[model samples]
Structure formats: structure tokens, C-alpha cells
Target: MRINVLQHTPNEGPGAIQSWSHDRHHEMYIYHPYQFGNLPTADETDMLIILGGPMSPNDDLPWIKQERVLIQQLLDHHKPIFGACFGGQQIAKTLGYQIGKAPHKEVGWAPVYRQTDAIPGIPEQVIALHWHEEMFAIPDQAQLLFSSDLVKNQGFLLGDNVIGLQFHFEPLADNVREMAVNDNTYPLDHNDLHQTPAEIIAHGVPAENKQVMYTLLDYIANH
Candidate 1:
């Protein structure tokens, strides 16, 4: 399978997703739109994976709009699409759903409760990394997949091909540490749900947790 990842920032590159691609021997391509602008051609992509970012979907950035156009095209073509965090919000907005602030910012490793039928190969509750301030309403056409104490719409699925996760399933321990250190300006001190860098890293990345990510990618590959 050929997987194309749309990365919004250098720090949030495809972490565990890249490991899955490598172990399966799938061809992987990355487009850091933050650096290169929107250059991926829809025709060249088979599976699309959009990673998280600090920016909101409604931000006036040029690439945000351009990526939305690409997302709509991918949805129309029925391509398998997986989006995380800001990417998930973009999917919701493109599907006619509203995106806005959650009651609180959910940062650090939080348990995401599965709400739909079991995801076949994945677990019910997983401690996934999160670093977002905004959340979105599940699109009317999507099946609610997962939820958390702080965020009700943690994930949703559209048919068998499109999946959107509000949490960070692709972050490795290193990625989490990098994000916490670099993005320290995130209202951590002001918010009750926020965690310190040492606290988050102390939990570390679980092996089974990473396997769940591979299972998701495997499902996407076969779909």
C-alpha cells in the first residue's frame, strides 16, 4: 500500500504510523505543508493520513483552506482517510460540521473510551496522547467511535473508509516529549487537565498502545 501523510508541523511527523508503514513495506510519502505549501496531487494518493497541528481548522492560513479542498476531493473519491486532531476538525468542517472550543483543553495521555461497535482489531480503551484546544461535532453521516471524559467526540467513522480521531494515536514517546517541550506555551499552567512534560514522559509509550496503531493502519491497508 502507498500511504501519503499530510503533516502540519515538523514535530508531529508520522511517528508510529511511519513504523507501521516500514514494517509492512508500504511506500510512504510525507508532505509538510507548513514548509512546502499544498503540493500533493489527489490522483497520486491511495491512502491519506493527516496528522495533528496546533492551528484550528478555521484559521485563516492559506494551507488550511487548500488542505480542505484536498480533503473534500479525497472524500468524494471514497479513498481511505485517517485524520487526527486538527486534521479531524478539518474533516468535520468539510463534512458540514461545526468546530469550536471544548470545555477544556485535553493534554497528555488520556484514556479514550470506545463508543461504537468494537473496532475489530483494536482495544476498547487506549491511553492516547492529546494536545488540542478545539473539538468538533461529529458529522451527521459519521458513526461515533470514541469519547473521553473531557471531549465527547474523540473519534468518528464515515462508512468503512474514512476515520477521524481527535486524539494523538501516532505519537511515539519521543514525539510526545518533543511536543511537550516545544509547545510549552499551551495553557498547561492555567488548565486543570494539563500535565507537565516530566509527568507525561514518565508514563512512556506502551508497546500494546503502539500495536493498536499498527492494527488501525492494517485495517486501512486492507480496506
Candidate 2:
């Protein structure tokens, strides 16, 4: 399968997702619309993985709108799509759902409770990385997948081919470090939910986190 990634920033590239694709021997490509204004059409892409960024899906940038159009095209084609953070918000916005401010700017390792087994293989509860101030609202037709204390809508599964997550399950230790170094004000403000760079990196991407990510990828691939 030709799995294309939509990367909004260099630091937020596909980490575990890339590994999963490689292990599966599926072709994967990353596109940077923020830097190169390039994106793959639905016809050329068998599956699409959208990564997160600091930007909002509600931004007024031309590429933001263009990305939404491409998302719609992929939806029309019934292509599998997995979106993380801002990428998740893009999918929500494209589906006419509201993207609003989260109660808190969750930015560390936190436990997310699974709401349903609709997408099987994920545990009932698992600790995942969080780093977003805005959250996506679950569409009426989509199944609520997960939830956290800071964000009620942690993830959602739209139909059988689309999944959106509010947390970071794809970043590895190096990717986490890159996120901290690249963003000057990474933590934004230290709080109960937000942890220091050291604290966040110390945990790294746990084995279970990587397993759950691979589980999701396998589910998407098989479907």
C-alpha cells in the first residue's frame, strides 16, 4: 500500500508510523504542505497519515484550506486516514465538526481511557503523550474512541477508514526531543498537567505506546 503522510512541520514527522510501514513493507511518503505546499491526491494515495503541528486547522492559510479539500477527496474515495493532533482537528473540521479550545493545554504523558472497542487491540486505558491546546469535537456519526481528563474528546473513529487522535502516540524519544528543542516555548506554561522537557523525555515512547500505535496501524491496514 502507498501510505502518504501529511506533515505540517519538520519536527512533527511520522515516527512510529514510519517504522510500522517499514516493518509491513508498505511504501510511505511524507509531504510538507506548510513548507513545500505539496499534497497527494486521493487517487494516488492508498492510505493517508496526517501528523500534528502547532498550527490550528481553523487557520486562514491557503494550505489549510487546500488540505481540507484533499481530506474531503480522500473521504469520497473511502481511503483509510489516521490523523494525530492538528491532523485530527483537520479531519474533524473537514467533516463539519467544531474544533475548540481544550480545558487545559495538556502537554505531557497522561492516561487516556478507551471509550469503546470499536477499533479493537487498544487497551482500556493507556498512558500517551499529550501536547495540544485545542480539541476536536466528535461527529454525530463517529464512534468515540478515547477520552482523557483534560480533553473529553481524545479520539474518534469515523466510519471504518478514518481515525483521529488528540494525543501523540507516534513520536519516539528523538522525536520528543526534537519537539522540545524546535519549539522555544514548548511547555508554554508549567502546570499540573504539563511536565518539564526532562520529565516528558524520561518516559520516552513506552513499549506499550508503540504497541498500541502499531495496533491502530494494523487495524487501519486490514480494514
Could you give me the TM-score of model 2 versus the true structure? 0.96
lDDT scores in order: 0.84, 0.89
TM-score of each: 0.95, 0.96
Q: Mind sharing the TM-score for model 1?
A: 0.95
Per-prediction RMSD in angstroms?
Answer: 1.4, 1.2
Query: What lDDT, from 0 to 1, does candidate 1 have?
Result: 0.84
Give lDDT: candidate 2, residue 218: 87
How well does candidate 2 score on lDDT at residue 34?
95
lDDT of 1 by residue, 1-223 (tens): 7788999877788899999889988899999887878657789888889999878888898988888898899899888888999888989988889999887788788899888773686777888887877898998888898898888999998888888899888888898888877887673655546687778778788777788787776765676
Instruction: Name the 10 consecutive residues with the lowest summed lDDT in model 1.
Output: 185-194
Report the lDDT tens digits of candidate 2 across residue range 1-223. Answer: 9999999988888999999999999999899999999999888899999999999988899999999999999999888899999999999999999999888888888999999888778898999989888999999999999999877899998888899999989998899888877763767575448588777777777779888999888887787
